[model samples]
Target chain A: MVRWEPGAQERLAAAALELYASRGFEQTTAADVAQSVGLTERTFFRYFADKREVLFAGQDHFQQLFVANVAAAPPEASAMEAVSFALDAAAVFFPDERRPHSRLRQSIIDANPGLHERELLKLARLTEGMAAALRDRGVPEPQATLAAHTGVTVFGVAFRLWVGEHEERPLGAIEADVLRDLQALSPSVR
Target chain B: MVRWEPGAQERLAAAALELYASRGFEQTTAADVAQSVGLTERTFFRYFADKREVLFAGQDHFQQLFVANVAAAPPEASAMEAVSFALDAAAVFFPDERRPHSRLRQSIIDANPGLHERELLKLARLTEGMAAALRDRGVPEPQATLAAHTGVTVFGVAFRLWVGEHEERPLGAIEADVLRDLQALSPSVR
Candidate 1:
């Protein structure tokens, strides 16, 4: 029987990020990450489909958190308001203590085209999932799509700022700031 | 001497889209596209790096057009205004007559995971290019990124609506409508 490891995924991910930084992503293997954490290559595979998944595995939790929060929003909340509620939920997924790790992870992703594309693909899926949740709330057509996309975009821009080496603000606060910037850009906002 | 075939690219694309729909994107080959267009396989290679390029070769032109329009917007134009002006320019690339072609192309893309990822990557690059152009106009940080992303999202939502079989509106008009929807979602709009 295989021994179940608690926190195995987080351990493997942190080890993988360290290796991916010291060695290039292409140079690192699942075995390396596994051995770094005193586990076998099979254990790594148990948590992630591949090395790429180590960086992206959080996508599922993020999608679920956003959708759940959107669904849980007040029935009368505006589309953007529902999305804002979701962003606050998403902030818990990236607490203040993880900023350094987030920065490293982002730099690694920015250096690799394949990883970058995977990130964009994940973000697109998140937007679609969030929109579907909003539609379930009866937010119609392009409004659902636009608000979902804007929420994701605001989260993205804010996350980028929050992860900057010199920036110490919390992610949720940055999201609120970016949301206002989005509002200001629209000359016709009510 | 390879005689330059005027409109060879267009002829090949239409033929490829038809074949991709009829025979399926996977079952089709580059040589098949060339033969359907009455050109040599070598000619197809000259025009595209691979069969996939047949669908994406226009991305370069799309990027240039968007960047050019963004740069050309009046100095007083807001970030989204610059992007909206660019969207009008983009509309010319997808006129009323091309709706059927676009719908077919999208169905093909939606059916394939790899092609969909490539499409997302291209949209991401387009957003980055637009943001850079906005930065050149002295736009800063998250606002430029937010506006650029919003513009692309608006274009994407509007394009999907414009290509619907029941929808007969012009692409530019749908774009304007989607933009308004985006503005209205921002409850704090200026």
Candidate 2:
């Protein structure tokens, strides 16, 4: 019988990231991660499909957050506003405490092509999910997709700033700054 | 001694796409594509690293076209305008003759996760390349990246319309229509 163990998933994820950082992603094994967490390999498998998935364990939850926030935005909001609302809602997930882990995770991803591709896939999925949510809110096609993709782009730029070595600003501040920058990207401004 | 033959690459690509459409991408092989083109496997490898690459053989040329056009746009043009010029230039590469092949390629990519991921990566590379070109043209940061990515988004939407079974418009027309739609997506416009 499987026993309910609180924080097992978090423990496994932390252990996996630490191992990936110290030993390189390619050299790390499921057994090493499980052992570091004082858990069995079976337990590790229960939390992640493979070592790479440990880095993306929160993707589904994050995607859900984005979709739910977009759906919850006021109907009067424009497509871009709705998308910004979703991104602002998603920003709460990245707190100050997670900054160190996020930094390490980004480095690990940068070092591995497979992980980089998975990250891109996750972002792509989030974009699609956001677009679908906007459509459900009576937003039209092409615009919905365009706005959703733009939201992802905003999030990406903000994320880099939020996690930069010299950046002490909160993710929310970075997001607002990035959104303003996006608005300033008008053709007439040049 | 290997003989240099004209149109060998094009013939291989056409044959590969035809086979992929008829027999499925997974079931098709480089040998089969070569045989279909009456060429040796070595000759096929000379043009593409693998069977999957046959669909993406034009990516490099297209990227060059985008960067060159962005650099060649009028110096006073806005970042978005420069990007639009690049997209308009790249549209020439996808004339009506390539429409059917493009349609089939999109279907194949939609049906396969690997191919879909590859397509996204290709687009990402093009976006980066365009951003660099924009920067080289004295466009500033954030706006440069934003404009380049938005250009890719416009290209994506226009490409879909241009290749849609019911659409009869040329790529350039669709690009203009999509760019107009994007401009209309401002927050004030709803």
Candidate 3:
């Protein structure tokens, strides 16, 4: 049995990303990732099902943060307002320090059709999770799902902008900008 | 050599769906689907890449119809209006006749994680295609993407309602209702 070690998962993830960037996702193996971090393959399997899971490790955390924030929003908040609060709260999970890693991870995913599909699936799950949270908060059908999906769309747009090489603004600010732009899509709002 | 046959694709798709539903997706094969339709396995490959493609055959058609309709909308129409027009136009692709097939297909897809991921990817492609068409119409940044995604979301919700076991309303009407609900999601609109 492999002994438990502190920061092992993070170490593995960082090594996996580096190898994926240099060797390409398709050419990289689980053993290569484990070896890079000086860990056994068994330990790597204990942390991730495979190499792809290393890149997607944060998706569950993102969903949890988004759902918890939406569920905790004040009862008086509108669906959009609640979504906004949740998005802002979730932004804290993605700090500037992680932006470079995100960019590299995105490039790796973009190059691989399989990884891209998994990314889309992850985003879809996040939207569904947020929608369920909205329903729990008493939002009605269709509206809750729509608001949750729109919030996710805004988050996606904001994330792309926020991760740009020159982008210096906080993610919450970028999210606010994208949310305003989304709202402006409504003729009445314009 | 397999001769070109009229409705060969449709025949294969129908056979594939029925087989998938009755025998479970994983238990079925290309040979089984082709044989069920009295066609050779070679003919099946001429139509679909694999068994999974049978259930997703409509995705390309859906994307073409949506993009063409959005592009053909009146120049004076707002982005949202154009999206509404496109969605309405696309509804024609799913008449009452196809509802049973669609419902059956959805159940098979829902039971399989791999198929569900492919479905999400297909929807993402549809959204991207519509967004590109909107941009072609000079809909401007962010708004174009947002409107396209919202249109796809409305399509999804309307589709679920339209395919319900007891749903009797036409797909177009359900789409209009869902679009209205989505619009009302904006604080200014409500």
CA lDDT of each prediction against the hidden true structure: 0.86, 0.84, 0.86
Clashing pairs in 3: none
In the range B128-149, model 2's lDDT, one tens digit per residue, is 8988999998988777888888
> List-wise, what DockQ does each model earn?
0.59, 0.46, 0.51
Per-residue lDDT of A1-190 in model 1, one digit per residue for the tens?
6889999999999999999988989899999999998999999998899999998877677778878999999999889889888888878889999888889999889889889888888888888898999999999998998888888898888888998889988998788788788877874321
Identify the superior model by lDDT, candidate 1 or candidate 3: 3
- What is the Cα-based lDDT of residue B140 in candidate 1? 93
* Candidate 1 TM-score versus the reference: 0.94
| Residue B174 shift from truth in candidate 1, angstroms | 1.0
Q: Mind giving the per-residue lDDT tens digits that candidate 3 earns over B1-190?
A: 5598899999998889899999999999999999987999999999999989988778777779888999999999989888888887867889999899889998999999999888888898888899999999998877898888888998888898888899989899888888778778774221
RMSD of each: 2.2, 2.4, 2.5
Per-residue lDDT of model 3, residues A1-190, tens digit only: 4688889999999999999999999999999999988888888999998889999988777778888999998989999889888887867888878788888988899889999888888888888898999999899888989888888998888887887778898887788788778777773221
- TM-score for chain B of all predictions: 0.91, 0.93, 0.94
Model number with the top DockQ: 1
The per-candidate count of clashes, in order, stands at 1, 0, 0
lDDT of 1 by residue, B1-190 (tens): 8889998888888888899989989999989998997998888888888888888877678778978999999999888778878888988988988788788888888888888888888888888898999999999988888888977897789888987879999988888888878777764421
What TM-score, computed on C-alpha atoms, does each candidate reach? 0.94, 0.92, 0.92
Off by over 4 Å in 2: A188-190, B188-190
